[model samples]
Target: MADSVRSPRERYREQVRDEVKRHAWEQIASAGVTALSLNAIAKEMGMSGPALYRYFASRDELITALIRDAYRSLADTVRAAAEGGTTAVALAGVIRGWALQDPHRYLLIYGTPVPGYHAPEDITAISDELLAVLLVVCADPAAEDQKSPFDVLLGAKRGWVAKVLASPRTVHRALSFWTRVQGVLSLELAGHFAPMGIDPGLLLAEEVAEL
Candidate 1:
């Protein structure tokens, strides 16, 4: 038991921090972010509130951490999809897959904005990375005739902002795709479709086809 009493390596703190964040994520999944409470989380962990404060200076810090993680996860998902294939179609499928797996988490990033809520710089940076992946997937030199609103908006440069101004149609397609997909996802997550007797998968496929 003496060895158990000994502290783990300082590096372990990061692991502990992740564990806390994972629990926090679970909480967010079950309930909206507005429902998150540190005391409740501590109780869920079978610890006192003070224990979590050691890692998160305040509730805001914990929320910021979660937002950052959400962005990173999205960036990784898009990056993996881009690396896996060409076709904007496939990339759009990847985005839908990620959103379906955890709609609540996706909304945490793109859902209705809260009043007075400001995201940290890293969140926007990660979001840009995700968009960059989309730009790469959508860019088609051979299919210049198929340019969308985004292509015109994005113009010639395909980096960050260039992707924004290339083709207006492509930009509209991207935004519409995102909003439609999220609309379906948000509705499903909120159980709004149960009464309508419509299959979300069908709606998702149709939206993807439009993209």
Candidate 2:
């Protein structure tokens, strides 16, 4: 399983896949995910459309690969922060930093849903990892146990809520953290705040600290 023991053919396959993904990302950035075309990527890579299909059978497959990579990178980043004893505000900053580092990556997952493309279950599991980390840092025994109406509603309806083994209040806090942070990032990335000249980072800090 060591890198030194991998066969040349395996290495070549991985290299090709990586190269194809690079081209796909370029296409996603230039146009949009809905406009991503395997044939276009193939032409860019100097390969026939059929040849590219061998690497990624369809556009959805290529998209799934990219989404998986993006989610994995984020899950790892947040998990690392949680393990380092990050506070709620610090963790919000971590998420904001990751999103700012790559707006396209952030928007790809959170900006808008790709029509006719449903994320596979494994992708859901990776996202669950993100929520799990949020729950860890959002836990506060000293806080009041008061639950709002939405918290009760989320607990009753959201299947993942009970599985995470946290109270509805904790779940509510985590969800609020996610939504507020993402709201700031979405607006900032879309140039909504540029004219206002407000700092998104400070705005994000205030939002998380208030939680």
Candidate 3:
């Protein structure tokens, strides 16, 4: 309600910012993130470079906004699945579906690092939300029977995991699950599996079922 009651000036500013981000995504699609130019976007939007700077102080700031949006979106999707009593396998499927729906957004967050770009601490907070949901869904009682060496090491500092009330083994399991899913998505998005006649979806199902 408070948001809807925002003054006209605030609403217009947000609209402009949103428009700039749309153009920025188009630029990212055509060229890479390194090729993003605020000045170019200003020309495309009929605004001077300095004027656009009022909306986004620097390219890094705009990139942060994009990254934050991406992470927040994935976090929300997984959180919803978790709240709906999604199982480990089902949650993995949900994540896979989300990635398939928007490969660009998925890659933007988890793909190669943007050179000279450092994500703010808030981005880490959003990513931690993802891990938290993974931990919840990955709590397998059968996993408690097997203790790997890595699990033993991870058990020592269960600081964050403890906050989520997940065992060290569950944390290990969640990490394993996340890495496998990400590996498949990264390779699949890059079109590496097509040439090999490999089915990424089947591969993902097998990987998640193993957990």
Q: Which of candidates 2 and 3 is the stronger one according to TM-score?
A: 2
In the range 1-211, model 2's lDDT, one tens digit per residue, is 6668999888887889999999878888999999999888888889999998888899899999999999999999999998988899898899989998988899899978999998899999999999999888888877646778988787787566768889888888988999899888899899999999899899999999999
Per-model TM-score, in order, reads 0.75, 0.95, 0.94
How many clashing residue pairs appear in each of the predictions shown? Answer: 23, 0, 0
**Order of all candidates by lDDT, from best down to worst?**
3, 2, 1
Between candidates 1 and 3, name the one with more favorable lDDT: 3
RMSD, every candidate, angstroms: 5.1, 1.4, 1.6
Clashing residue pairs in candidate 2 (N, C-alpha, C atoms within 3 angstroms): none
The residue-by-residue lDDT of candidate 3 on 41-133, one tens digit each, is 999999999999999999999999999999999999999999989887788788989999978788889988999999999999999999988
> Between 1 and 3, whose TM-score is larger?
3
Q: Can you write out model 1's per-residue Cα lDDT over 1-211, one digit (the tens) per residue?
A: 3546656864566766887888888887788787777888788878789987888877778888888887888889878777876565566567667877877778888787644568888778788776666555555455667765555665655575453554544554555666776677778777888999998777776876665
Poorest 10 consecutive residues of model 3 by lDDT?
156-165
lDDT values, one for every candidate: 0.72, 0.89, 0.89
After best superposition, candidate 2 residue 118: deviation in angstroms?
1.1
Q: By descending TM-score, how would the candidates be arranged?
A: 2, 3, 1
